[model samples]
Target: MAEVNFCLGPHVGLRPAVPGIKRAPDPPESYSALELQVAEPPVQQLEVISGVESVQLPCRTTAELHDVVKVEWTDSGDRKVHVHSCVPEEPEDQNQVYRDRTEMREDPLRTGDLSLTLRFPTVRDNRTYTCSVYSRAGRPRVETRVELQVRAQQVEVDSGAESVQLPFETTADLPEDTLVVWWCDEPEPAKKVHEHGTESDQHEVYRGRTRMREDPLNTGIFTLTLNRPTVRDAGTYACRVYGAGLIFLREKTFQLTVKGVSVLLLCAPTAAAVSLNVSPNLQQFFSDDSVSLSCVVGAQAGGQAVKRTAGGQTDLCGSGFGTFDGSSCTVSGLSPSDSGVYWCEAACEQMSQQVNISVCPRNDFARCPFILEIPALPVTAGSEVTLRCRNKDGSTHAVYFFRNGVHIRDTTMQRVKVEEFSVSEVQQSDEGLYWCSTDLLGPSHRSWLSVRAPPAPPPPPSVSLVRLICLLVVVCLFCICTVLMVLMCCSRKTGNKSPVAMEMTQCFGEYDDIAAGISTEHDF
Candidate 1:
């Protein structure tokens, strides 16, 4: 138990003094109870142009304390101020308006920082605010005046027309007398379309199409609708508030165009008849001897038809075939010129279809005549001769040469060599009626040869001498007959005398010419 002390210092009544136990010494001032002091009051910054949702305040203090601290706030303004703290729990004592928004914590004391946040802040709610801090040793308080400002909502639209619709999310608290205006660069005169109040502000073009929530003043919603949108109905539109000196603006645009379909052509084998079909006009077929072409068409009412060059579309008749209709097309009469891929196009309602066609030619070398010719004949034996073998059809594919009904060789001879068969020299052995023939393509031709031996040499002169001697003997005999005739004539006269007489006459004449020096060897 500690001692008790009673003492009365001179003032009102009689005094009594009883001090038996010594009192504890008073603590030094440094360790005594303390009270915090702020150098300046907290102040919320203000701006003429401001946002509707938030406000900032600048505040500072001069208090120096080393202990846990607690902060308290009170909204002194007439309007509601929703207070919020970055800390975890709500403060001990707070205004009813901040009952749901207030927060507090111990972390701020450790960091030596303090701040308060107000939610759903507004211009009308701006006012003075007071903050008090309770420390282990003392209590400190700060007061600040905050000015609030409201910034106008901004809207923008992109369009060529004079006016457009205005759209908004929350329209609550919006005044009924709010003004909305439409703006754009006027070609002739620069002016703006101004309307007052949400009710009377009707744009002629957007009149029936405009609408708002039942309680526009409370919901703060303004919506404009367009029933039949047109290109001329597009431009920038905005809402303005005259009292608050604020302007809220929004912008829009529209575009217009026409629609349409297509036409196509089709063709096939270039040398043959081509087929085509169309809804609008009949297809045309054209050809030279080398190529045949077919045109396909579609109705002009729905679309346009055009000719597409080669390689423009896929061929319906395989890779080389060409198509012309929206479905298919073809071209025929295939020549060298027509031997390419073709395309046909059908355009309708801004859409088109393409088709491809291909063409090819038939081979004509298979039908030439097979007849061959053998130019000249009557070749001499053993003399070199050439046989010309030619096809009447002029086809060299089947030209073959034959000798004596047997194929000897092919006729690949040069100019004159093709004319005849040659033999080095004329001999009796080569005396046959020789000929050459060729099965060029169709028929064959044959030629003949005529060979004869030369005449024999003249006979010897000895045989002629022999024949002359014989002729001499016959002359002698004839002479003897003549002598006999004469002798007989004489003998007829002298025969009567005797035959010896005639002989003696002949012998005597011969001996007499001989004795006379006439060479008798010539007569004898």
Candidate 2:
């Protein structure tokens, strides 16, 4: 058994520190009845700036050990910061405050790198963290401690305010020669907002705009005051304190944002360069058609993020039938199920205006009476078309109509049983997005009206010029033959009329009449 001896006098009640152990160490390895020495674990100091994404509490070992059980990390308040078990089947029992924000190495036992990273670290995480390693026998085998100090804050204000205050205070008693400076990252190079030391070079813009409550930041109350705040002053401002010889003591970072002019595109109308447009951009489309929607973010330098919410399910642009590229998403072979609301998110944390896309079901509205009855097919020009606006229930209010999002007509001045109305001999110009509504049902779903061109009239048929000439030639030959035969008989016997010319004109007229009949029959 090892005999534990305490140092006499002042060190009697102190911790486990090796006897005669100083800056140099060549202590005996094994402890028996003879005198022995055991080294004390050192505490590492970590100075982290707040407002950063995260900070790491490092604990590592190079010595070889065996039968590892678990590694636990706890804060000064005895709250569990992180825990990793060697056994793979156990569930994590982390606190709710640090549930999804803590992460550790996968295999701490093998690699001996038991480091805990705290995400979105704030001033609340500033404390001492103890890392303890246990063996398979449920005994602590190794221990180490770390002290973390987080520095920063966040401030938000509205534009046109008289003055804004970046508050910073410390309970630690600072030196008289301490220098405090508030730096802003909003400008090109880092600019000093307020300096409380000897005269130094200051930016021209903030010369008369900044001041401090104290003359020299004597007791570490280094708060800054800026006059006439504007949208250009929105950025990170850090208050850094320095002691004698310019030694850094503490720091607090502030994310200062002035609203009104510096707001996101989601709600503001000042973003004139950005545009969102849709192809075949009508309010509705027939089923089986393809829809292409695109957004141009011009100078806004954020990655593209487009989302569609349809049928109570939200999906990104790259899933299902939608395909995404730089700033656009395309969905082809659309159906009624593809109808939804879509919007895009810019990298500046700004969101574009939402768009509603409707993939019409080609007149399959047998289920609900809450839609405007549109023509299933295109109506011909100069043809009467009937539109029936369905309602959840009937009403006596006059039906009002809208075409292409504009009020164009109305009907039913008296009490009408039917909630629908019709239009007669609709011109081609009347075809557009149409909707009907009454005082009770509000308005029905919008539908598009299409007009087709009217058919041309038939022309009268005429006889062919070549056929008429042929008929005349054949008639002349027949008449000449008959006349020659008659003249021969007259010479042989007695006859008095002009036999050749007698029936010539009459033969021509008769043939012309017959030709007209033949042509007419062929045409029919």
TM-score of each: 0.24, 0.28
Q: Residues 229-249, candidate 2, lDDT per residue (tens digit)?
A: 666568888877666777555
Q: lDDT per model, in order? A: 0.37, 0.64
- Tell me the tens digit of each residue's lDDT in model 1 across 357-450: 2121223223323212221222344455443333333333324445434444434543222433445675755433233333433323222233
Q: Compare the candidates by lDDT and give the number of the best one.
A: 2
Residue-pair clashes, model 1: 68
Q: The CA-based lDDT of model 2 is what?
A: 0.64
TM-score of 2: 0.28
User: Pairing residues by index, what is the TM-score of model 1?
Assistant: 0.24
